[model samples]
Target: MSRALFAYPKQAQFGRVLPKNKIYEHTSPSPALKALFVQQIDQIVWQYKLAPETINLPAKPAVPEIQIFDITLKTAELDHDVLRCIDKAIPFPIIFQLSHDNRIQTIATYKRPSEADNNKWVIDGYFADDWQPIETPRQPLPVALDLQGLYEQLLRRLLPLPPREQEALKNHVERLAQWHGKHNEYQKLQAKLNKEKQFNRKVEINAQLRRLKTELEQLS
Candidate 1:
């Protein structure tokens, strides 16, 4: 915590003059509504690799130029009635411009909470930096859609490892995942393949059958 935050000093009791009051409101919304909105914005953040930064804002974000990204409002929770009723409220990265009446106007508006703590307003000036790809490893998107093909692709990348190496790698990977608080399904499989490739081994079902037959013949 900043010393300014913890120290009030002699008589500045109404609270120190931080511009935080001029920025976004931090009131908690309904849990369901809050989760619904946050998830939608977080998707955009991940897709665009948008770096989250906190800004002190009070009003809703202003309107900004139209964005090219395809943002569908298909989630059942976000609809016209649920969203449009708030006054001057919109999502972030909005563009506000001076109008003919000498008043400012927003060309485009997003009005939902931002990608950060879900409380700040994203200003056009702040979002001016072009977006980059999100390169860091991320948890797989929860099973809202099919991921079989994606998982297969990852497996293909791992199928070259040898048996012993695969075993060690798989165990190592599982242990690493345990550190992160959850098991990663695909990574574990990848680790196995990596081990197999390292040992130059491949499982052959017919060969295993022939081995069993030889063992029975020896017993006979």
Candidate 2:
């Protein structure tokens, strides 16, 4: 049997296993209300698994608020379990990381049906290195939603770009994302260099830092 792990906000607690029935009694009247309820659920799940009374996970995560499940299960089976645990009407999004053979092979998102669409069990994003089309797919793996226009508008509001500068804005955002990723790598390397006692290893890390700095300059 595959194991499924979940993360909730820190304020809530769950027993040994998550309940398969609806945990919240009140109905959400609006999308905002629903989001708040889901946030609470996320917080509860997070706290339940990490609290001292429970599993007591490490205080510092490689990435915070993301809990990795130790149990392994088929993708279909795990999705079924997650759906059973969450309310259908609430429309909360849950992310799942599927692993096998000591490596995560797939990352999938399970979300409730949208008000404008009729399709159920839509997989928003399924990323894998060895992805192959399922001949008899159980769920619909639809194309990712395109929010470029909305994203552009938000960027414009934040930066107040001049008219007819769409391409420039796109390039700027892409470069910003690249720079942030490189900056993270730079920080990790700096930490490693500090702890590394080997002279040869320190030399290699210094070379990497020089390359990263050049890339950062290009981005700037």
Candidate 3:
């Protein structure tokens, strides 16, 4: 299988500190949102600019340019709302590299311009990979026909579900979202089954879990 993690090209580097307040100014985040940024985040940097000029990939309407943000964290985990806030502030698609305690993880949500309003973008659910050492080796970016394709490949790397043969990116992401729901259902059923003292209730919960497992497998 091809490696999902990537090492971006040198020509694409755009190292610059992106002030947290700059994002807050654009988005007007609520107090709780500001707390997440102040407590969990240490710094944000614009690490790469994967545009036509930098990467030689033609831009599509939905994916004109991809920004890579490298965020160093105060803790290991970050709220997805923090990422969504940054996405709302910027017009382009973004890929995040989060660093903490000498480890790094890549995360992103499938984002695109809203069909009803070209001025706004729609952000789908978040996906992330397990953390690895900062020194971990990475594969080169995937070969693609355009920036849209590259963005799809980058997001695909973080997705838990692999795309079905010839599946469009939208359909694949939808299936992954379905799998998340089904998997959650299965987990809840399993927990209920384990905690049930009555034999008959355990049997009923087990049956539901089996059905959910099948649905999850199909979605996967």
Candidate 4:
């Protein structure tokens, strides 16, 4: 994965503190989720807003604007549900920057409008880069013809694999989701194979494992 971190243009900075109550008001989060928010999160800032006014890119239907949120964490790890809650509260696509102990990591889900309901958005899955020092040099935002194109490039940076030539962003995200499913299945098969004591069963498990490995290679 190339450097996924980016320096937002100063012109795009929002620099407003977003209170937890505001999110709660919009989301009406469950009690458990609310507790998680209070325990795991320290603060949330509406760090940057990428729009036609700020970035001078025409907005696409699904991506009118991209919001960058800076989240200060109380713990090193944050539950995905926390992010899900925020995404639910906000209608627009979001890119999350997580901060912990002076280190930062970028994370976002493949979010887009639902085919069945334009008012609703479907979040495919979360993708993240490893944490780095806060002062790590950041790359300038990728040049894009429109907000949708800019969103695609930003999310692509977090994926483990590069996009195939002329591939749509949705297709790229689907491919990565498939890879993750197969990877998890492979790990489970390996665990089952390790626990199998019978030689006959071992051979069967090994054969299945080899087949899965081949599939994984093709996906990669």
- Give the candidate number with the greatest TM-score: 4
What digit string (tens of lDDT, one per residue) describes model 4 on residues 20-71? 9988998899999999999999999999999999989999999999999999
Query: Which is the winner by TM-score between candidate 1 and candidate 3?
Result: 3
After TM-score superposition, the amount by which residue 19's alpha carbon in candidate 1 deviates from its true location, in angstroms, is 24
lDDT to native, each model: 0.27, 0.40, 0.91, 0.92
Stronger candidate by TM-score (1 vs 4): 4
Q: How does residue 198 of candidate 4 score in lDDT?
A: 99
Each prediction's RMSD over C-alphas, in Å, is: 22.3, 19.3, 1.6, 1.2
Score every model by TM-score: 0.17, 0.32, 0.95, 0.97
Shift of residue 68 alpha carbon in model 4, Å: 0.4
- Residue-level lDDT tens digits of model 3 in 80-187: 999999999999999999999998888999999999999999998888888888888889898999999999999888888788999998999899888888888888
TM-score, candidate number 4: 0.97
Candidate 3 has an lDDT of: 0.91
Clashes of each: 27, 13, 0, 0
> The CA-based lDDT of model 4 is what?
0.92
Stretches of candidate 3 exceeding 4 Å from the true structure: none
TM-score of candidate 1 to 2 decimals: 0.17
Q: For model 1, how does the per-residue alpha-carbon lDDT over 24-105 read when each residue is reduced to its tens digit?
A: 2443345665555454322211011111111111222222211112122333223222232211243333221112222211
